[model samples]
Target: YLNSFVDNIDEMKEKERYLMEELKNQENNFLGIKSICSNKVDRVEEISRLKIEMNRLGIFLKNNQGLNDFSIDDIQNKIKEIEEYYVSDEEINNLQNKINEFKSKIAYPIIEGVFGILEENFSIIDKKYEEAIYSSMGSRSKFLVVKNEKIGNELLSSNNSSISIIPLNKIKPKIVPGDILRNVRQLGGIPITELINFDEEVSKAMEFVFNGYFLFENKENARKACYDYKVIGVTLDGTLYDPKGTLCGGKIICKNIIFRRKDLLELEQSFKEKKENKRIYEKEKYNLNELKSKICNLREIKKAKNDIQIIENSIKFLNKLIESKVDYSSELSSLRQNIVKKIREKEEFLRRKNVLETEIFELKNKIKSKKEDEKNILKKILQLEGFRRQSEIKISKKSIGEREEESLELKRKHLLQNILKSKSKISKLRELLKEFKSGKNENSKSHLPVQFQEISDVLDDFKLSSNIFNVDLKIFDVKKEDELKKELFSVRKEIEMSKNIKK
Candidate 1:
């Protein structure tokens, strides 16, 4: 029984040694897993924050995608349509060209150079026969009447001057004899002098255009008057009979020069409209292009979703891996508890063995003393009876139980074993408890590692990206499109840098 007990103690010692090794291994494994969990937690949280930002940016892009005002192509087409009437396509090819280019295409207003038109100063008293004078005057009616000869010289000196200007100071007035006028009246002629609605101030320019023409009722009367009076005669039909026997008729444009101003004013108004339309289209195109750029950013974000999801999956796997390690830790702690139990059991057995060995030593000494006493007593008896006697007795111990090692030595070993086992259990249990609490707390993801500056920096980056996504871009216009594109490129580079850091 003693040998078997010793063998049992040796077996427990061997088991304890093996279990201690396993405890060390388990501790290492637990710590390694814990470190991984801690490290990955920050990364996962960073990515999660990034994920939310990405989603928000994506939503922003989607909402902005609602209805872009105009595409660049559409804007160009609209600009072309608006300006085509005024500016030719060849002129439009130069983006610098503007609606002012169209002004050069329309005719200049005659009013620009002259003080007044010749016809504006005159109105025949007989409104019914007004056509005779204007038709006979023809284009001569449109001659510009300048304020003076100097003004006329200035007009003629201008590089773009093409209209004829008559200076009031330089014009000569023609007079008709009284008898010729009376004869034309007798021939049914309305005298040109009676028809002239001229003020003395502008009468010279007026008479220069209308003085020689007289209106008779018909071509026959006009011819008779021109032959009899040897002066120019005009009918209401605009047929002119010249004293030189030349007849002119059948052509009329009474209001041609008057329409010049109207045509130019209309063209100017239309050009302004085209310019305004072009401006509107340009602004719309700028907004549309900005929208397109944001949508492109949205596309990049969607593209990165796959990578984000993979990281999320890694986090899930890591969390599960951490949870799975819980069982191993439990086994390790159980082994430690068992080792303590075995140590206690071994201590108890050793205490009993020590006590039995001490008792056995006392018993052996008493047996030896009794043997001496009995031999002496028997010697006395032999002497008295003239007889001799001899006695022999042996006490044996089993080989494994033979007390080769001292009781003090065994006590020392037992005390040392107790101290080592107790201390190891206490420290290990403390460490194991710490690991459990850490793992449990972090498993729920409620823990924030505020101590890590890297995480703080990552959060700042996310906020910056968020701000970029939410930035109001309406302040910029078409002129600032290039600046916006540069900013976009820089933001993309920052995002890429952040991605690299996370990886």
Candidate 2:
């Protein structure tokens, strides 16, 4: 009986030990529950703060002055109009201003030791043969056509370093061979010296310069006269054929007053384009600022929504822990699962945000690249203009001749054609860029609720379709109108030149 009692006491001791262990485990579980509940409370506070921030950002975005003032369609239409408005008149006015400014800076040299200056300026009698005389004279046209030899000698001895005086008195006319002359006449060619209407005093100078040269109607006749008949020949288009089986022909870029005008016009056009591009960049930057604010608000709303979800999940877990019997292992497993799930959710949000931010960064980089390209193009245009102006200024300071004017008019036409082509390309690029921006804006709208996204997409599609239709119609109308206007302008210019020639 005593042994049995001892066993019972030992059993009670074992039971006490078991009870104490269970009590310690319950205390540990209580501490864990407290920690989890505290964490849930902290998450609730964080969620509330995030909600407040989101609401604030939303309100700010909704009330944004610039963004709220205009509808998207209105803004887009204004941008399109700004892009399409023609600035050619501005270019022309600026060019005229620059030409006037350059002319104001020119200073002519004064000869201190020269004798009496005799200026015997001769005009072209026949406009049809003006090109032939100008081509035959070549660089000699820059020289002053004077009749007195002593005046030329005195001018050459003067202190003036800029004078290029040519006296007709000292010139000896060259006599062409009879056989060559006969061959040239047989080829429907006229001697260049015979085409000019000049004073008798200057006849020797003209003959000395172009007595052996013959002008033909075309290159084929000129080549026949030179290669087959063995005589020097020139064509109206400035092709030169020598008697020694040599031919020189191509477009001539003469350094004269007429070319200077063309260069100035091109520079003005480039400047206007650069200015327009700068304005576009400025406007885009302003729009980007508004977009950035809107994106910020969207990101905040997304973060707030995620925070609310995490907090709600944490509260639910805490509630489950409070209502159930304290099972430490099971509660730990549940808490761990919740933590892992929350971590995955946060990671997903971060990844989405990163992707959005990356897209924004890429868009910014593209804009920067375009700006750099535009800057480079503007720099190249300015450099070319500077070089052209310097070269033009270095040439002789004389009035533009009829042939030079004609050449300049042709060059201007060619430049206009090139400008038209460039403008077309620029317009196409602008349209593409506008479409890309519109698409990007549409993509941004996808982050909103599904119902809102659908509505926005429908509106965007309608606007896009309308824009496309209008653009097609406008392009067709503009093309026809521009062609007619160009033809009329050309005809008017020809008539004006004809009247001037008659005068």
Candidate 3:
């Protein structure tokens, strides 16, 4: 019974060792799957970043053109959300170990086997995203074949029958070997590949290099690895890879290799049927690339036209201002010149009139001095001849003298009133004479003489008229000036119109 216990202990030890090895294997397999998923996730993220950068460039271009439709802030928020799916390798390894530990806890072999199958199945499905990235790059050729659209409509429909040839050089694929697929790689990232459908009628295949590398990198490696990717060659028997199509990923099979049936058994399964979906897939990819380029060019053209129109409008507005200002220019110049000439003439006339008035004032002072001397001499002679009043006169002389003095005062007062009245008449006559001399006489009394007699008659007539209406004679001159201004305005308008017609 003790020997049986020892045998049982040995069996348990063997089983434990086996379980440990299985656990280790499971861990390694999960790690490998995680690496593949990580690579896919990287590819998805990198492509997304590049698309974002392109969109940013477009936004900057619009901003430079003064358009304000897009917001960089909003785009940055979206980018932050996309970043959430990224996972570190260390974290993935930790998760893998946990899954392995959970799987090892099953007691029955059947249960363990079932769990292993499940794990393997999940891992395969996860690997499909990586396969998508490889397929997208591999089947992408300048030359592509159209496929039937029967399988879930993943390929083109039969109603449309054509192949599309895109020059690979024109396609802007943003991937290099180092850039991994992020969806398969990152746990929560978007799928690394996009499937598109094509109309076979409008599709055609062509031969060209696909440039999928940094422009400034080393020439040989960048060009050969990226631009010179090869496609499958067609054979006489209508077989793609039977002649030579690479079954294993990332290697190209160009020349036909004959192999025995035993060698064929050793080789991996050839996915010739899957190539049909790939062909339509490639055509759809080329179409999408062409469409994107057309869209970019159209946006650029629209921006250019908008800029041109703005400049054109500014030029037109300035031209209109110039055209409108031109019509007023000639009249403005003539009026300015006439004003200057009149100012100069008025200045000269004022200088001459001042000198003439000084001479006239001196002559009037001399005449007044002569009249005063004569009156003084007559008063002295009358004092020496007092024979009428000295003696016998004491009596009746007082009444006769009083009466005569009263009569003399009355006569003097009448003469003085007449002289004062003559002053206004003389002033008006002198003003008329001055205006005539200055060549600015616009008075209606132009036929009247410059002498005092005619001036007195005109002044008397003005006084009589003013008394009758209780109006000042001076106001008549202001009324005449207003009428002259109205006449001048009408004349100016006529002259301007005539000048425009001549022009």
Compared with the true structure, the alpha-carbon lDDT of candidate 1 equals 0.59
Q: Which residue ranges in model 1 land beyond 4 Å of their true spot?
A: 1-113, 124-127, 159-161, 256-503
- Say which candidate scores most in TM-score: 1
Q: In candidate 2, what are the lDDT values of residues 8-100, reduced to their tens digit?
A: 545555655655565555555556565654554564565566567656655655555444444555555555655553345576576667756
TM-score pick, better of 1 and 2: 1
Candidate 1: tens digits of C-alpha lDDT, residues 1-503: 45554555566566656656765665665554445545546645655666676676657556656434435555455545544434443533442243344335423334543545566666667666667877777777667777688877776777385777788887887777888877777878776667766667776787776666788887788888888878788888777889897878885656532433334455566656656666666656655566566556545655556656655665566666545645645655665676566556656656665665666667678889999999999989878665322221112344334564344355445434543443443344334334434665443222222212333343354345335433233422333435434544453454444346435
Q: How does residue 456 of candidate 1 score in lDDT?
A: 39
Alpha-carbon RMSD of each model = 58.2, 48.3, 52.5
Model 3 sits at a Cα RMSD from the real structure of: 52.5
Q: Is candidate 1 or candidate 2 better by lDDT?
A: 1
Which candidate should be chosen as best, given lDDT against the real structure?
1
In angstroms, the error of model 2 at 483 is 93
Q: What lDDT would each prediction earn against the true structure?
A: 0.59, 0.57, 0.40
Instruction: After the best TM-score superposition of candidate 3, give how far the Cα of residue 310 lies from its true spot, in angstroms.
Output: 1.4
